[model samples]
Target: EVTGDERYKDYWRFLHDGGMRPYIQRILDHSNATRGYRIDRLEALAADGIPAILETRTYPKIGAWEQAHEGKPWYTRSGRLEFYRDEPEFRDSGENIVVHREPIDSTFYEPNVIVADPRHPLLRPRRPEDYGADPRDVGGDARQARHVVLTVDQMLSSRHPLAEDGYRHVFHTPKYRHGAHTTAVDTDIVAIWFGPFGDIYREDPRIPFINEMYLDINPLDARELGIEDGDYVYIDADPHDRPFRGWRDNPEWYRVARLMARARYYPGTPRGITRMWHNMYGATWGSVRGSRENPTGLAKSPTTNYQSLFRTGSHQSCTRGWLKPTWMTDTLTVKGLMGQKITRGFVPDVHCPTGAPRESLVRISHAENGGFGGERLWRPARLGVRPTYESERLQKFIAGRFVRRG
Candidate 1:
């Protein structure tokens, strides 16, 4: 759809010729105008904002920090980058230096072994001398000068099980804006990032029903479960009992927020993978088909499957807890906001130093009954109902026996 790079020759654009430095300067200038006013007047304080921003967010490889601390050594004990840190955690972990290790959850095709490269790929600095990655520091274990084993490794080794069902696929929850100008899922607004269309989707008849929820399965996997494309299926996970802040989800790993969605066959999906797009069809809104055959009720305010009782309303219902991925911590010292480490947080909401809602091992079965309705419960109680006419003779007999026809 892109006609040409210079389509709007005069208007600003991120083209091939321009570099990030200029683009960033423009953003810094704008921020200094609007954002810098809180500390002091923008006119007075704006001139100094660019240097502050560069030293903070942008590439600091050769920025103001280099000049500010010209003689002072960096944070390391050696005043240089140390591949083998003298921390007990590093020595204990066996990772004194860098080593190539596989992902914790990787289904083992080969033995889970790692090859250590203690020497620098580019600069082979000698050990006890120059302090580049020393080969002796590469191999880790107790008694060996190798890398320290990490606490994260032990945490990863403790396998967390979700579902016992024979078939649990590698699950990913993808972000599909059922429509634009929405919150977690779809809403009544047809919004672009900026401009007049921000509230436009409210009246547009062409918007698809956004509340209906569905899980994407590979075509080959669909056939194995006897699930045809568009068939309803009940998706669930194993019990997980942990404390979730109760803002978006709950604490239990196995606690299931059950809802039903049609099984959609996604093209090019490999056999052992599944995906569910967020917030679409459910019991309330999108599922209701208009009564008129010809169809004219298009302009009405849009409604998705609202009021999902089990929280199965969105794909994140199954995503719970955390998995620590990376090693070490990044200390970001900020000013004015009381030295807020923007990347780090004490709680889950502000920052989850863990991974986001990505992969899950889940169980899927055919939802034969109409989803979210009491179809099965209502059927079982049908035998208890008796007609009043049939019970009239019994009522009279009981009255005569108890009251003697009074």
Candidate 2:
């Protein structure tokens, strides 16, 4: 019996390593040989070096080309003659580039996402090592790089099952929304000074991927909060004790959350942030569920239910995440429905400062709905603490800064 083979395994590796250089060179040679004068237009992008390929002017001009290809049958009104047939110029132009229906796959190899093993030549740096670098394996830093900076789009809809959620099954729409105003390379939004790519908004750098999480609150969580699109809600997270949770805590956590929560309201004019579909992010295993459809698991859809975790101090609503203070004798506890004893823990969403308290569980109060009429009217509130902005943001900025610098 014959076993199936992985046809495209080496296909990508070979193309990236060997094909890219030749392909670019060929394009350059062909463009030079076939001058704009030969084609009679100034659309050639070869005037500048390879870097020019990324310029806006070099972007392909697809305007009239589309209309011409889609132009209706070329017939004259009076004689009903076909211009395309009668005119040699028209015919030549039309026959030169035929537009045919065909399927198109836009997937292309991205250097950052492709994992590079020891054998991959591209992973190797130049010899003699620049600037006192260690003479390590050719796979240098590539071996250490594990996480990929995924855009909200690819992170949400990729065929990877981890990319989806049960909410997609129930609502037929993604439950989470990640917001990104600009590319990671040039986010002008202010960040803290924990490191280089500091937190953009406040002085704190504990917020992780603030740009990413902001989208969740502004648009996605906005709907759940009963706030209309473009509307804002204030958050009031009470500082929790340090003992029940971890001792690490940052006092600025609450204030940072407030600032970030406010910033989400205005995502700027030009770089208006786009809300990413929810359930597309977070720890791979942390928020997911289990079932036959997804035996490994399905991400717990970030929903209105999770929104409850952020409600703190009176008049405060935490749609994004939560904040907890680090100190003893300040803890709160509550029991779960099944008497499951759950302890308070810091929200893993963002970074926290040293001596900051991790968030723990808290009681939730709700009025009896009459389903089991005669029950206590207003019961104790539910409890749980999520990561505050400072803690989360600091962790992300530090992690990213270290990775880029190292």
Candidate 3:
């Protein structure tokens, strides 16, 4: 509403034209990589018009991006491609330069005393333990480390190891939902793309993959798990909630979030990996859950629809993920320009926090009656809150998509 409406465009225009200019200018001023560059060049190009530049018909590459500094010191903290910073922190942290740390799996085995092939003199065998530290395992902390440590030994261990050890599979979720930006999750758009196929040729926006959410598993793994194609299976994100400081007696610490979805055995899918197309469910009001008759269920928008429980299928619920706050070198500098207030301002998309759920492990199994007792099963919104489903705005969306679908 804010971006499309002209009334709302003024503020946007000011940020792009007024504020963005200075921000870019600041980067250009400080970024030595952008040495010998000026914003005026861009301004001049814009002033003369793009049509004039097009008349030349010659493509020209510009600046440090092209082969770095042709004849000058390239811009950087070191005025060169900085593999190492002169900063003491790099030296203290043992990351003085780019170095390859073996995957945690490599640490599981004793370090080979013999070098590989022995063709390269520089190559040397790795030590099981190094840097005067006892043998350690790289667990939950990809905030970084590498070693074969039982996750039970360390609270922070690698998630991949979990699937390899106890958990049966690693559930990978990618942002595949088309919201206001792509398909734009709205009634008018949904009408055009309600079902999977609009034509027999099988060429339509509503492809089978996009119409609903399903678990993509390898055919081999599917057979092993006793899951047939189109079977509604449960994906249990293990360790979804763990007790604080080893809460062995507390049952709450062992809770899991189970997401139900139809299984699709893809031939090319790796044997152990399961991918759930993310952002598809729980993004809209009536999001699909496990299947048509049984969805993951949903909670009404707490901020908007209080009484209504939306069927926004589950995804994030199945993981112990946390928002990863962006810690850029210098993201937030200035605010409050062109009537855009300061306190309410949002960090730009580039600096926005994201959920790092790679540590969330899951195992697929048959879901009887949705899911297990200790698992979080999606439930429909029960009435009790203000701004219920009776609200004029939400009712219209429901009516347009589900009610008027005759």
In order, the Cα lDDT scores of the candidates are 0.40, 0.26, 0.41
The residue-level lDDT of candidate 3 at 338 comes to 28
TM accuracy, model 1: 0.41
RMSD of each: 22.6, 29.1, 15.8
* Residue range 1-406, candidate 2, lDDT tens digits: 1435556554455575755544444445455332223221223534543224322222464433423565632212332222222222212212212222110111121212222232432233222243344433212133122223234444344431211221110001123233342223133342222112223452222222332232223333333444332222332222232111221454433332331211132223222112222221232111221111233222222442111111111111112122212211112122222223433322232223233222211111121121112221101101111112134446666568545633
Off by over 4 Å in 2: 1-10, 13-50, 53-182, 185-206, 210-263, 267-283, 286-406
Whole-model alpha-carbon lDDT for candidate 2 = 0.26
Q: TM-score of model 2 relative to the true fold? A: 0.22
The total of clashing pairs for model 2 equals 57
> What lDDT does candidate 2 reach at residue 250?
41
lDDT head-to-head 1 vs 3, winner: 3
Q: TM-score for model 3?
A: 0.44
Which RMSD does model 1 reach against the true structure?
22.6
